[model samples]
Target: MAVPFSHRLDWSIATNRLAQALTLHRPQFDLTASNPTNAGIDYPAGLLNAFQDPRSLHYNPDPRGIESARAALNLGPHTLLAASTSEAYSWLFKLLCNPGDAILVPRPSYPLFEFLARLESVEVIQYSLRYAEGWWLDYDSLERQLTPNTRAILFVNPNNPTGNYLKIAELHRLAALCAGNNIALISDEVFADYPLTGDQTRATTLGDNGECLSFVLGGLSKTAGLPQMKAAWLTASGPGAGEAAKRLELIADTYLSVATPVQYALPTLLKHGAKIREQIQDRTRANLGTLQNSHLRPLRVEGGWYAIIPTPRTRGEEEWAIHLLENERTLTQPGYFYDFESDGWLVLSLLTPEADFAAGIAAIHRAFTA
Candidate 1:
C-alpha cells in the first residue's frame, strides 16, 4: 500500500535537518527568535498573580469560551471580537465549506497555515503577496488562484516575516470578494498587537453587515508574550446570515481542547496582556532603532517581530547564513526557510536581547559587506 502522508507534509521538509546543524555549531547571537521566554526578556510578575485566581478551581466550560475572555477581545481599541470562536469555526465550516475545500492563504507569510489546513483536511492554495511596488498584496494573483474548490481566504495581518497589515481598503475588497462568492474569511491577527508604526490600527473583522463570515485568530503568544500560557482564540464575527452560529458551536464542542485552568484564568490573563504587549513593543522599537542605524537595510515591516533584510547583490541568503554561522558565529534565519520568493533575503528576530540584536546586526553587516 502507498503511504498515507499528504503533500503538505513534504513542504519545508529539510528545515529540521538544517536546524539540527545549528545546535552542533553553538553559534552566538541566535537571531531565530520566536519564543518570548527564550529571548532573555522578563515577563512581569503580574502574569503569575493573574493565574493564581481561585476561580480556576471551578470547572466552567463554555463551548463559547469564558464570556470575560471574549469581552476582553471585543474591547480592543480598533476591533471587536465576534462572540464565540467555538461557534465561529463550527459555523464557518458549515456556512461556506466542506471537507477537501480549498482555502486561500498568503505566500511569503508564516508556513503554519499549511499544517493547520492539513489537520483540518483542507487543501490550501497559496496566493502570492509578492513584493512589488513595496510588498502590496497581489490581488490579481489571488483572483487567478480562486476556483470552485475555494471556500475561504486566510490572511495574517501584519504578516510574519513580510510585516505588512491588511490595509483598510484592501479589507473591503477582500470582504466583497468573499461575500460575493459565498466564501469565508479567516484572519490570523495574532500579530495585530504589534503594528510597527503609524496609526497602528488596521481594518477590523466586522464585515459588510455580516454578509461575509469572518474569523479572527489571536492568542497571548504575540499579544501578551506568554506563549507558554497556551491561550489562543478564534473570534467569529459577521452576520451569521444563516446557521453560522450553530456550526461554530459544534466545532468548539468537538475539541474542548483548551485546559480548564487556562480557560478560567483567561479574563485575568487578558487583563495583563496590555502590560506584556507594551514591553514587547518597546523592545521591538528599540531593536528596530539599532537595526536602522546599522548597515543592513530591512524591508519595511508594518508589524510582527521579525524583519526581512534584503541581502547583498553577490550572495544568496542561505550561503550568507551558513557563513555567518560557521565564521561569524552568529545565527540567523535564511529567507528561504520561510519560503521567500528569492534567495537574496534574510530574516532577523526583532525580539532578540538588545546586546545580541546589536551584535547580530553587526555581524550581518560584516557578512553583507564582505
Candidate 2:
C-alpha cells in the first residue's frame, strides 16, 4: 500500500552546503556549528548520573511533563521558565490555524524559522532588523504588516548572528502590542544564558502580570550542552491563560514529543547548567578576544555563541567563505546562509575549541588581507 503525506512536510528540505561540508569532511574545523557538544566543551559526569535514574522506565506521561521537572524549570535560570501542569497548552485550535495564517519573523536572524514555520503550514512575513542603528528591530514594517490574519511574531532574543538582546523597554512595548492585538508572542531564547556584558540574571519573564500571552522556547541544546538529549520546552505564560495552555497540552499529549528518559532527567540536567554555562562563557570570551585581536571588527555581541565579522564588500561573503575553506581548510558560515541583509559578513562559532578558534581567526585575517 502507498501512503500520502501532508504538504507541510514538504518544507523539510535537506540542509544546504553547510550540511554537505559536514558530510564531506566531518573532522574539519566546524566553525559553522552552534552545537556545544561538537565544540569540544566537557560535559560533567553529573549529566549522566542524572539520566541513569531507573525510574524513567515507569512511563508516566503527564503531557505537560512531571510536576517536579516543571518546578525545576520555573526555579531555574529564567524566571519565565515556570509553568503549572494545568496551564500547559491553552488553545485547542492552534493546529487549526491553517497554512495561511501570517506570522512575522525577523530578517538577518536564524534561518530555521522559515522551515519550521513551513512545517506548521504557516506563512512567514519578514521584518527587517536594520543595522543602521546597531541592529534594532524595524517596528515600523512590523506594525504596518499586522493584519487580521497575523497570528504571532517570532523573536530571537540575543538573536543568532546578530547577537542583540531585546531591551527591557522594547520587550514591554512588544508585549503590550501583542496583548492589545490579542496576538501571541513566540520567543526563542535559547541564547539567554550566554550574555557577555551583564551578569546571568533572568531577564524579565514573559509572564509579568500576564498582560500578553507568550510562549518562550528553550532547550538543553545550548544551555547545558545536551542537544543529543533531544529535550526542549515551550513555556506558556499569561494571566488566565490556562485555556490556551490546555490546548497546547493536547497537541503535546497527542505527539508525546518529549522523550521519557530526558523528561525524567530534566531537574538534574537543569541543575548542571551552571557548570556548562561557565565553560561556554569562558570559551566565548576567549574567542571574542581572538576576534578583537584579529582587527577584523566583529559586530558587538552582547551575548550568544557566535560572532559575525564585517568583511570588505569587494570580496563577497560567500566567495570569501568558500575560498577560506579551500585554501585554509577553515569552515565558516557565510552571512547569506543566515539571511544577512547584505554582503561582507562571515559567522564563526565562539564555542569552537580555543586553539582552533585562535587559528581560524588568524586564517580569516589572512583571507581578508590577501
Report the C-alpha lDDT of model 1 over 21-104, residue by residue, as the tens digit.
Answer: 686788888888888888766666766766676777887776666666666666331222222332234345554666788889
Measure candidate 1: CA RMSD.
3.6
Each prediction's whole-model lDDT (CA):
0.73, 0.72
Q: Which ten residues in a row have the lowest lDDT in candidate 2?
A: 84-93
- lDDT of candidate model 1 versus the reference: 0.73
* TM-score, cand. 1: 0.88
In TM-score terms, candidate 2 sits at: 0.88
lDDT of 2 by residue, 1-370 (tens): 7798888777546776645654555435657667778677778865788878787879877777667777777733222221221122222125325658878888888887666666566777888887753567778878988988887877887788788877766777788888899788877777878887762432434444356877777777777777777766666677435665666666777766566777778888887878988999999999888887888888877788888888777777877777777777788888887887788889988989988888888887887888
Q: Which candidate is the best by lDDT?
A: 1
